[model samples]
Target: MPRKKANETKTYVLDTNILLHEPLAFLSFQEHDVVVPMTVLEELDYIKDSKKDVARDARISIRSMEDVLHDATPEQMTEGVTLAGRGSGITAPSGKFSIFSDLELPEDHHVFTSNENDNRIINAALYLQEQKSPGQVVLVTKDINMRLKAKGAGLAHVEDYRTDQLISDIKYLSKGYHTFEGRFWERVKSVESRAEGRDTVHTIAKNILPEAYINEFILDESGEFAGLVESINEDSLEILDLGVERLMSRHAWGINPKNVPQAMALHALLDPHIDLVILTGPAGSGKTLLALAAALEMVVEKNMYDKIIVTRSTPEIAESIGFLPGTEEEKMAPWLAAITDSLEVLHKNDENVKGSMNYIMEKANIQFKSVNFMRGRSIQNAIVILDESQNLTASQLKTIITRCGEGTKLICSGNLAQIDSNYLSAVTSGLTYLVEKFKNFSGSATLNLDGVVRSRLADFAERHL
Candidate 1:
């Protein structure tokens, strides 16, 4: 596929994961000078030390340069790939993106490798800023907060690496159903009514938010209810009320009116056609439960969706694996345990379901695989639920979302403030990050899931904790 070129001419220095954003991300830098800091290379070396998955991801990133960069020979590469920056060249040129190697980490002199390495890489870009101070020395990073700290330190310009944003907010998305926005009430009155009676109520309901109910009539010029009733789900919204209705339809197991998240889930379930759906909320909220119900209704009851796939971010749980030594699955036991608890809650040890559950575990479903396994494959027709998505880097989220196949539905649910991903905060974590970006596209919907449907104790924790 021909890469869509960016018209901008800023100098974009990438943190390691930015290099990992699908092939097109790198190629998109057509006329720009892309910088790969030496510290990032050091970090990749350490990352590749973990598992075959990390090693494989590292290779994919390196291969992105196959069309443009070349290897530096002994005479040239004496300093390494960073210093001897020549890889196979095949790009439009005005001086290619420079690999600025030779930066130092004050701590290890080992040239920053971990988070320490990420800091040093941006430090190198700062050094570059001192040297060239170009139009905008933008450092594109998936490290949510790195961009912030970098800006605070001195890199004046920092932007998200999102070529595409995940559709998260319901109002903004190009829904399956067309909506008459409240914003249109003013203009539509000027231009004739773009939408008729029922649409007017849906539009007003969207404006009011939550469960929409109003006594006002949708009158024509003659001032009447227009001989039609404008009724919305006092508990749930009609599928036709969504900008993304084609993806959502009336399923036998409907979303509960009290469960506002259900209102959001229907959008995800209805859109079996949509491959990725990000649903986020705090603890005590029914993010996981709602997801399970949707999967059951679609896969078991309706036979629309294929399989139920569930995973979560392993950031906070990485330490547990350090104590248990074995294959990666054994290592990830603690993180994946949360999903198991949810599964247990769903099945409660039913023999008929146990077999399929065991298969999911052996095959990496229950205990089968980690997000690392999801990278290369195009997951299809399956309901992929990523709980606690807040702990993922934007790049990590991108990798997960792109892994979806033609008939897949990905549900990403997490509380923005509750993230464990290094350097990520409420605004920058993967959950909210995907939400803010893709809130306005076709076949995509995101629900912030405001109300806590769990017990009072759990709700109190999310509120105060």
Candidate 2:
């Protein structure tokens, strides 16, 4: 246990959403006294038996909490139990874990009523603030409104749980590329060229683009040059030259690039050497369309992979999926409609559109799956298209990414602006985490499709709205 200093150790009261967002969140506070409000426990108990996706997380959180406090006596439960040897790194095993019973707060003592769970949690924080006296008491939650209410009710310290947030602002996130104004050669004082098969590799000074990473694209205003950063050394870098004309003419299952960003995205998606491709952009930037096209081409035309697996997270997937009677694919159809829509767009000009769609579906062996059922499966030799990835947390994405076995390629695509999860933001999203973490990996590539090519209205809305 960490040595306690007078009035320096804080008591952090955790809300239910924090545990739901991350099952082991309680262990993150180092050397601090962690308190779980009784109201939060009740909410977890109620949600544990439900069919929601978070039900499993609730069970895990309960198990983790019980494992820490199971042997504690009734009096010890009210006091804090030592959290030593339970966690590591950002998770401090030196903290004290306890449960706070806010329901016993008298009417005169309570600042907020115990009728609602949020209010009750707030009252618990207020109670701790008074009880702890000179020490600090903070309400840590992912809910914005709850934080506001806690502060309004006279709780001095309130903070959003930010252990998983890798970046503070979305603008600091990598766009997978760097653009040099005018000619890129003008800045390059010297270079060494070599031919490796059909591709030409160029060695240049690292100062030319010191911030470049592996598989990152390099472009210029003149539109004459485009290169991929293949390797980075101590004082220099190696780039694989990909001419602009060649990138623009690249095709994937009859879909052509409409812009340079799209061209680079298609290039990354088509490369068999790249195992993971992350696409991020605004709505109507063709993230899904490009991913689907590349998957179809690689699976059907190129015969690179045996099948295509498509999955995404939906709010109602867990609760409504089981109640809606059908096979796994049929039950997942509603959520995977975006994939089918892209297939139609790909084969729209065929003689028989439905026949072509059915033929391609069979030929490629496309499978629609739910994020809820992706656990404990070793997937191999397939192209996995994970759409709407911005809504996923880093741990949730890790669960799916680790399932990819040998010869598997995972394409993660999402719009950071369209995050639907209450606890997630553009910078804290799993997509952002994946891009930043894998940018240095040689087998991964990221592309930020810049334009809204769906229609004129989409372009205008993306800019103005």
Candidate 3:
């Protein structure tokens, strides 16, 4: 509902991908007649053959459009939801250039597309604008640079194809690479800082800064605090220790993944009273395995919860994965390996446990679900583990967490720094988003796992590489 000048502009140009991304974008221009801008249609010609999912998704989209267009029929194509190309009987607006108006391409930025196509798309809008001056013609594209180009060409109006995105702002976070060299980092409960120096620091900053090394001693990865920020304080790092009884309890989970930090995280998570735990670690940290094991034990032996719920983002981009070469179980062998490996170790340590988790799997006592099916389901009295939680967007993460039912405890674990998609980075991922936003709330604790315990070689690769 953005308003532009009441000038004569009346036509909206749909970028080819806009239709493919949203698939239903064609009908969105109902308030005005939309121009596919002949050149935009041509762009689809090539994508029609792409070997990627986006390309396949594109094909499905174009076909859907065909129905809409055909259903409208030539009669309907002319005035509303019509199919006539620009310059047809509708009269080409002023300043409008012929289809795909020829233009010189800038060598640097124009390297990807044969400027032949992009320029024409731009010209289509320009042409419609000129002829229908004051008619309000604007270009809608998914490309950030493309939007900038439209502005540079004097077509100041443009918008993103928001089909795949939700508009909202979340604070950005930094991925600090600290070695935790004993002397430099001490886990404390609180710290204090003053206007001037001296340990007698008197101020009530309290444990306001939960992740700090000390109250007044703020430092970066280099162990110094004077570079970018100046805050006076004594902060606290609340630490909880779990003894062997708690470790051997029916609900206990000893993480085998090679990260020493899980030892601390396991302690925090084992406390039945603390219902929510967030674990963030690098790729091999074993966050998922630990959560899964805890969930299994809590269900099987402790009778702590009715079942174990596991979920992760679909990683829509990684889908083909090709069917596994084994039986249905074997096909998912690779994906299930992580979960099973964790279970194997859990059983190894606790002789009281026996058999394949097949009983749980067959009975659906332990549910392995994709993030796609989690909508609107209220999960209760269960131990829920949201694996690869970093891959989730802030809103998606919030949605997943809100699904937890009463007596349900949810654990979100993933390395914010290890995201596989460009749409979101460490600073903006849901994992870090949760850490920054929910840090101080009681009954909620987060443990940053460092020290790769995967193996001598694994540790070496993690630290050196």
The number of the candidate with the highest lDDT is 2
lDDT of 3 by residue, 1-465 (tens): 575454643567777767655555655543355667656656676777864334644676567566556656454553445333423343432221112222432343332354466666776667667767767777888666777877887785787654333223322232221233333324333444443432222333335344442111222344322111123235423212222233233235444333224544665566576678888777666676677766765676678788777666645653433443544334444554666676676557554444545554544386666565576899989888777788766656777888987898888888766676534555546677777666545556676666665567877887888
Between candidates 1 and 2, which one is better according to TM-score?
A: 2
Please give, for residues 1-465, the per-residue lDDT of candidate 1 as tens digits.
565253345677888766544433554454566777767666666765655334556666666554344655534332223311332455433435455664543443332355576668667767666665435577888776787778877777777665544443434432222223344234232211234554532323333334222211122232211211134444422222332232223343334534423454554545555555666656767677667666766776677766767776665445334466788766666667666665665666677677756654443333235676677888777778887788776767888889877777787877765766555555546666676656544456665566787788877877787
Tens digits of per-residue lDDT for model 2, 117-225? 9998888888789888999999999888898898888999999888777788989888988889999999999999999999999999999998889999999999899
Taking every candidate in turn, the Cα RMSD to the unseen true structure, in Å, is 9.5, 1.9, 11.3
- Report the alpha-carbon TM-score of model 1 versus the true structure: 0.60
TM for every model, in the order presented, reads: 0.60, 0.95, 0.53
Q: Candidate 3: deviation at residue 331, Å?
A: 7.2
Predicted model with the maximum TM-score:
2
| Model 3 vs. true fold: TM | 0.53
Q: Which ranking of candidates, highest TM-score first?
A: 2, 1, 3
